[model samples]
Target: MRRLLVTGGAGFIGSNFVYFWKKKCPADLVVVLDALTYAGNIANLDAMKNVPGFEFVHGDILDTKLVERIFTDQGIDTLVHFAAESHVDRSIHGPDAFVRTNVTGTLSLLNAAKAAWLDRGSGIPHRFHHVSTDEVYGTLGPDDPPFSEETPYAPNSPYAASKAGSDHLVRAFHKTYGLVTTTSNCSNNYGPFQFPEKLIPLCIANILDGKSLPVYGDGRQIRDWLYVDDHNRGIELILEKGQAGETYNIGGSNECMNIEIVRLICDLTDLRFRERASLSEKFPKALPAAGRASRELISHVRDRAGHDQRYAIDARKIKTALGYHPKESFEAGIQKTVDWYLDHENWWRALMDTLCFSKT
Candidate 1:
């Protein structure tokens, strides 16, 4: 069994990955390292506390000493690097944090891994898997083909640029130090335990609260939306059978417009309210609870600064090479996501009181 250290394990995709990994490999030791940032919630992993071989460490990835200590002390054989400052609007307002955490923090992890696994000559087989984003390819023309692994880096936002930097660092470590690394640049992800600040969760939360569903520009931006669990499955395959020093692109094969997604969430939430009488009592303020449409809250706002037009992923390499493919269709995945938020009000409500979340 692999002794794994997962960074950012309290956040959206990371937490989901942690759960997925544990369910598949019950005997493997899974240690989570998170700083408990605005997005990271320790409660995400609360269900696993009673399980054996599970450990949680509250810390920053930038702290090389602490990271190396965890590596050496825990005998960590695999490092799944997911810790990152990943909000687009936040990056636009405050880019320093993104650069510090994404670029410098990645370097720190690389150094710690190199020291613990290579420098000591322990001869332990190891791997460093870096999770990246498809935004590094920038926007796409309406008729242009989807982004492939060979797409040139042309990041438009500070968040994307910072992630691109980290991706380069991972490649450098593999080439220069032979760190046995693999990277996956995945498309947009949505599922349970996601921060309410993101599109799907944000819309679901706002719709329940009878708040405006803010749409940027014309709201026609296209994106390939990957379910969070499917993204994790791709990573699992890569870790099991992937070649070192290569990068994989993971996608959901769902290309949808922003406004279409907002409308879908609104329609789905309304359906849930209509189907359950208890929901109206729980969330009386919801428009659907009053026999009105949730889509009435739709409000068009100013577009984001430097918003990318579209992003679609060409995931053939992973599918052809390692038999990796997404299992969830958008219709089924979105309904499950909406139902999760409806059932877990306390989870997202606690996160809603934050100063940053209020502004968003």
Candidate 2:
């Protein structure tokens, strides 16, 4: 079994990956390192606490000493690096954190892994898998083809720029130092346990609370939506059978305009709320009212600074090479996502107080 160090294991996608890993390889030693930043919630990892072969360490990836210690102490054979300041609006307002965490933090992880896993003949064979985003390809015209691995870096936002830098660093490490590295650039992800700050969860929470569902500009920005579990499964596949020093693009093959996504969530939430309300007369009428009032709650706001208009991934390489394809269609996946938020009220209630930080 592989001994893996997963950074950012307390955040949305990372936590999903952690759960996926535990279920698939219970005997593997999985050590999670997270900074527990505003977006990182310990509750995301609550299910793994009692599971054997799993350990969580609350720490920042930028801490060189601590990262190196974990690498050496745990004999970490694989590094799945995911820690970063990922929100676009936050990056625009405070880019220093993005650069510090995404670029410098990635550099630190690469250095530590190189130091610990060099000398493969005498040490365990190791792999450094860097998780990244498709925003690094910048915006696309409505007719532009989906982004492929060869797409040149033209990141428009600070968050995307910082990730681009990290991607380049991983490539440099593989080429210059002969480090075994693989990187995956994925599209927007949505699923359960996602921080409410993101689009899907934010809309779900606001719809539930009767708050205005804010849409940026005309809300026509297009994004390919990947189910979180599908993305995690692709990562697992890469870790198992992928060639080192290669990059993979993981996508959901589901593309819709931003407004379309919000509308769908509204329709789904309304249907669910109506079903529940019919069962109990004591249930608040406002709940059903607000659910039906979803479309009216849609509000158009100023667009984000330097917001990319569109992002879509062409994931054929992974599909052709590794037989990896997304299993969830947008229709089914979104219904499940909305139902998850509705059923897990207590899980997201604690996160609602932090909504002010999620400026879209």
| Predicted model with the maximum TM-score | 1
In order of appearance, the predictions have TM-scores of 0.99, 0.96
Instruction: List, residue by residue over 1-360, the lDDT tens digit for candidate 2.
Output: 899999999999999999998898889999999999889999999888899999999998888889889988999999998898899888878999999999999999998888788843437789999999999999999999999999999999999999999999999999999999999999999998888889999888777676788899999999999999999988988998899999999999998999999988878877876777642243243345543457778899998878899999999999999999888888999999998887787888798887555434
lDDT of 1 by residue, 1-360 (tens): 999999999999999999999999999999999999999999999898898988999999999999999999999999999999999999999999999999999999999999999999988999999999999999999999999999999999999999999999999999999998999999999999999999999999888898998899889999999999999999999999999999999999999999999999999999999899899999988999999999899888888999999999999999999999899998999999999999999999998777374222
Top lDDT model: 1
Pairs of residues at least 3 apart in sequence or in different chains that clash in candidate 2: none
RMSD vs true structure, all candidates: 1.0, 1.8
Q: Supply candidate 1's per-residue lDDT for 95.
A: 97
